[model samples]
Target: MFTGIVEELGSVVAVEDRGLDARVRVRGPLVTSDAHLGDSIAVDGVCLTVAELPGDGTFAADVMPESLRRTALGALRAGVPVNLERALAVGGRYGGHVVQGHVDGVGTILRRTPGERWDEVEIGLPATLARYVAEKGAIAVSGVSLTVTHVSDDAFGVSLIPTTLAHTTLGGLVVGDAVNLEVDVLAKYAERLLGAVAR
Candidate 1:
């Protein structure tokens, strides 16, 4: 589990395809400082196990085909930046929100409206995941925890401040760019519980 708080902005150093899976080597000195083999790292909101820790500020992990199909990691190329976060330690502060580091689906940036101090980014929401999103709710986009500013039937908007724009890869997002989306896990659990009670 993670808190959706980005520890570092890492760069993809290399991607080696191995038929059904790919080995991704990411350069994130901060996150890899005390990393060990088998540790979990959140890459662009996808929880990936550390396959090898070289102790050289670089870590390699395997990305299965299923993960690629569900998230934007499959289309990643060398030099691309990604949000990196270490797994939450026991009794650690939940700075952002409860993030499983599991990407539910992918969304696309539809438009961006710049404000004096922040920017409002509107993204298209997948129909299947729409029910999980709500205004003023927590949503993880490309591993960054953001609050929903508005929600329509098929899309939602998030306002990004300067700090977010400078620290994460979201600031570089353009129109039509694909992003991984993870809705609040609590909301999903509450919905399930309510459904069970109703039944």
Candidate 2:
């Protein structure tokens, strides 16, 4: 599990394809300092296991086809920046909301409205995941947890402070850019429980 707090803005070093699976190497000194084989790292919100500690501030993880199809990682190329987050340690300070590093769906940036103190970004919402998103709710976008400032049937908006804009990759987002979205898991669980009760 993770807290959806991005630790570093890492870049893809290499991508080696192996038919249905691909090996990815990302360079992140902070996340790699204590990383070990089998450790979990959230890359752009997708939880990937560390297959090898390359000892050069980089780690390799094999991305299965299922993961490739479900997230934006598959389309990434060398030099592309990605949000990196280490798995939450036991008793660690919970800075952000609970994040499972599972991408529910991919969304596209529809527009960005600049404000005096912050920026408001509107993102296209997937129909299947739309019902789970609510105004003022927590949502993870590309591994950075943020609050939903506004929500519509077709899209949602998030306000990004200057700190988030400077520290994370979200600062460079533009219209038509794709992002991984993970809605609040608590909402999903509640829906399941209500459905069971109704039945």
Candidate 3:
């Protein structure tokens, strides 16, 4: 589990394809400092196990085809930046929200409206996952926790402050770029319970 708080902005150093699976090497010195083999790391909101931990501030993880097909990680290229976070500890503070590091689906940046002190980024929401999103709710986008500033039937918007824009990979987002999205788990559970009760 994670808190959807980005620890570092990491770069993809290399990607090696191995038939059904691919190995990814990411450079994130802060997250790698205490990382060990088998440790979990959240890469762009997807929980990946550490396959190898090299001391050179880089680690390798294997990505199966299913995860690749579901996430934006498959489109990653060398030098592409990604949000990185270490797994939450047993009693660590929840700086953001409860994040399973599980990507529900991928979304695309539809447009960006710059404000005086912040920017409002509108993203296209997938129809299947749209029901779980609500205005003022929390959503994890590319592993960074952000509040939903507005929501429509097929889209949602979030305001990004200067600090968020400067510290996370979201700062590099361009129109039409794909991003991994994880809706609030509580909302999903509530929907399930209410549906079951109504039946």
Compared with the true structure, all predictions reach lDDT values of: 0.93, 0.94, 0.93
Error of 2 at 152 (Å): 1.0
Give TM per candidate: 0.97, 0.98, 0.97
Question: Quick one: ranking by lDDT, best first?
Answer: 2, 1, 3
Better by lDDT, candidate 3 or 2 = 2
**lDDT per residue (tens digit) for residues 1-199 in model 3:** 8998899999999999888789999999999999899999999999999999879999999999989988998998889999999999898888999899878999999999888978899999899988888889999999999999989989999999998899998888989999999999999899899999999
How big is the positional error of residue 109 in model 3, measured in Å on the Cα after superposition?
Answer: 0.5
Cα lDDT of model 1 by residue, 1-199, tens digit: 9988899999999999988889999999999988889999999999999998888889999999989889999988899999999999999889898899889999999999999988999999789889999999999999999999999888999999998899999999999999999999998999999999999
Compute the lDDT of residue 80 as modeled in candidate 1. 98
User: Model 1 shows how many backbone clashes?
Assistant: 0
lDDT of 2 by residue, 88-155 (tens): 99999899998999899999999999999789999997888989999999999999999999898979
